[model samples]
Target chain A: MVFTTAVNFIRARGPDELWRKRRIFKLAAHFIGRKRNCYSIAVRYVHRALVYATKGRKLKKLDMKDLWETRIIAGVNEHDIDYRTFRESLYRSDILLNRKVLADLAAWEPYTFKALTDVAKRRAIDDGLASINNEHKVDGIITRGALTKS
Target chain B: MSALKRVQQWATFARIWHIYDATWQNPFKSAEVVKKFLMGLYKPIYHPLNDCGDHVIIINSGEIALPGDEWKKRVYFHHTGYPGGASWTLAWELHTKDPTMILKKAIYNSMDGNLQRRHTMQRLHIFPDANVPKSLLDNVSNQIRQLRPVPTRLDRYTAEEVASYPKLIDYPKDYIIR
Candidate 1:
């Protein structure tokens, strides 16, 4: 298509209006009633849906973190260790593991998780960071505090 | 699915009954541990939407220990939907009223308040004493370990064992009279 003047060429939209509306209509296909058929209405709902999708993506991560924390708490509690102590002990021992991996270990690899908790418990007891009520005695664990006392 | 695979699948999803001895255990602390089994959080296949919870039989709830002065300080509140029908019961009073009520409330409050809360609670059986029905006991193949070691009371210890116990220092004869 040729424009008669420079102004006419500038004013002409690059793509056909039909194609522009089709993009939005494609997304709104599953939507009900006028929102699916009408271009103006479809565009509004599509924009809103896209916004929700964007927000949901972030929310999904937060929700998963919460879930992993819950699972880790449950796993730690099973071995009579509090979640904070377990994580702290692991960190102090230089056994770096993220919550996702820890949660996975707690669920699918329970025995491995138990071993990890045992290590954590020993470390916690040695460091004197364990809860008083735990009262679990770990053999062969000596810390700076004990060495200085002796 | 193949026959062996079918059996494996059934085993994966099968509900297991677990027994927990709550004697000398802190009810509030035990509730946190019990909630996991009740909700099947220990299972790898656990999901909020999934029906993968297990049945938990809690025995000797009457023997549950309250930390510090909680037995007298902790209050359980209840209100009837009428004018001035509210009542607050202390932990000890509530325990005396119903041995299982404190533990039951602890487990109930431990979980998130949702539609599933009540349903999940249905799987928990709290017996005041170790008097659970044989039918329920027959179903239990696993025992949930207590969170803390049960203390041996002075009266519960054997006289010979107590006498043999090593002491750092002996009390003076005159000081020991009290």
Candidate 2:
């Protein structure tokens, strides 16, 4: 507890405290007061601000998913089908395309999406799915079932 | 850009969820579902810091239920910072004031204490009387299933259906059934 220099006053809290304050200051540097000599004030706001930054990252992902689903729905609507039937058909057919890929195909690759939709349509017909157009095309045709047997 | 890194990022960042309002059907159980949707915990890519939660449009919030005596006993506290500025409002009173407040407050308190939470709260859409705007109605792409079957009211039952409804032991002709 003996100190000969001014270093002791800042060092009294230990070297760890100094680095913690420095880290917070670095994070808050762009902001107003945290970058200044106000250590106590900076500590409280910086922690809260950092928490917000982290939470924002998660929120961004949720937003992206919503956007993707919407894009897919919009794209699907053009094909004379609702998103649910299209998606349920996709699931039943075991195409395994996630929302991101489905949305991309719906947006950029119309033919590819159409092909997938056709495949889903075929399976949907086989599964006796309700609420779809073109059920008549695949009805009473056991092509998939026949193929599996042969 | 390695393909593996690109795939990893895609897997980490892409997902949306859908929720249905079962509050009118089963109020107590529906709160947990609403909380999960608001928190964005249903997705594999969920992270504490990211605002990756999906938009939750809860219809029929005005008809939601509170189990036990919570509707009367549960109180929300606020302060104006004046001398004796503290005020407490019962849950039912708050619900009457703003039908959405119950769900909103439930979501708000469940979320982590952080600045980003307000942005997440913006995604919550509650319709008290189910007369929601068309824009919000369009946003509902899917529905979360209710935990319990919504019971049919007597008014909705047809004469045949009511007659067919299972009867308790036919009281003996001598005994008058109330």
Candidate 3:
């Protein structure tokens, strides 16, 4: 039973790891042993294996989230925007793209990424949120517009 | 080509070979029998240790005719792992989010959460709609037929029926004398 458990753990590290880590085998081991009535030791081993299998399934979501963020950061770097700043800017501008969609776009499309960035910039300009480097020239234009309106 | 593929193909062939549908114009309905049938829990080959079984696709899950007020009275409970975090969601709510989950949860509870138990569970499939997609229906195509089995009662009699029956004492004394 110990040897089989060790083998299963090792096999679970392979590419088709999901199947290897699956709880079916542990359940079978316990059930078969229980039915035999004499193989109680195997039943205990199955119980332990089931606990580990369930734990692994719960961790799968966390692992998938980590993969998604890694992909997103890689994509963000390609577009010349620091990951944190770009994410903040997107939220500040009210872009509602989820991490899954963002990661997909980053990996599959570069032109779309640039267009998104450009829209964010345009929105900032229209909202009067972007800080102007030359205040005097923009101030003169603003004063001229106010005078024309009067 | 792969071992898994070969095994899957063989299992599919085997399942198709033994599939059957039967009907009784009037048959006894018991919770034990219904649970066993719905969960695929009755087969001789049922292994609590292994998930080696054919997939069961339950059609018209919503249309399941319950025996009594079991739908309203039965409650499911879960914990979020925080103090005072125990929550109870009604069976009806679970039916909407994923109707398949209602039956799946029942089966899961019956199987007792063990490693092998989880494996066999993945083989079971429940679709809320009568028309399951072609991809899923492909496996059971040989056995697929309109199972209009006379809408068999899930339980023996309704509460109203049980209440309406006259007692021996209710019989008229004059009728007995006659």
In order, candidate lDDTs are 0.87, 0.71, 0.51
What CAPRI-style quality would you assign to candidate 3?
incorrect
Q: Comparing candidate 2 with candidate 3, which one achieves the higher TM-score? A: 2
Ranking the candidates on TM-score from highest down gives 1, 2, 3
Q: Is the docking of candidate 1 incorrect, acceptable, medium or high quality?
A: incorrect
lDDT of 1 by residue, A55-85 (tens): 9999999999888988898788778788899
Each model's TM-score for chain A is: 0.82, 0.72, 0.51
The segments of candidate 2 whose C-alpha lies over 4 angstroms from its true place after superposition are A1-150, B1-19, B25-29
In model 3, residue pairs whose N, Cα or C atoms come closer than 3 Å (at least 3 residues apart or on different chains), thus clashing, are: A23-B115, A27-B49, A27-B116, A28-B49, B51-B120
What DockQ does every candidate get?
0.20, 0.04, 0.01
- Chain A agreement with the truth for model 2, given as TM-score: 0.72
Off by over 4 Å in 3: A1-150, B1-51, B141-148, B152-178
lDDT of 3 by residue, B58-85 (tens): 5555544444665676677989999999
Minimal lDDT window, size 10, model 2 chain A = A133-142
Tell the DockQ for candidate 1.
0.20
Write candidate 2's Cα lDDT for B1-178 as tens digits.
Answer: 4555433433334334455664555454565666666665554334456766777887878877677888999999999999999999999899889988887787677666788788878877777876878866775767877767667778999999988979987778899667
Top TM-score prediction, candidate number: 1
TM-score of 2: 0.50
Chain B, candidate 3: TM-score = 0.55
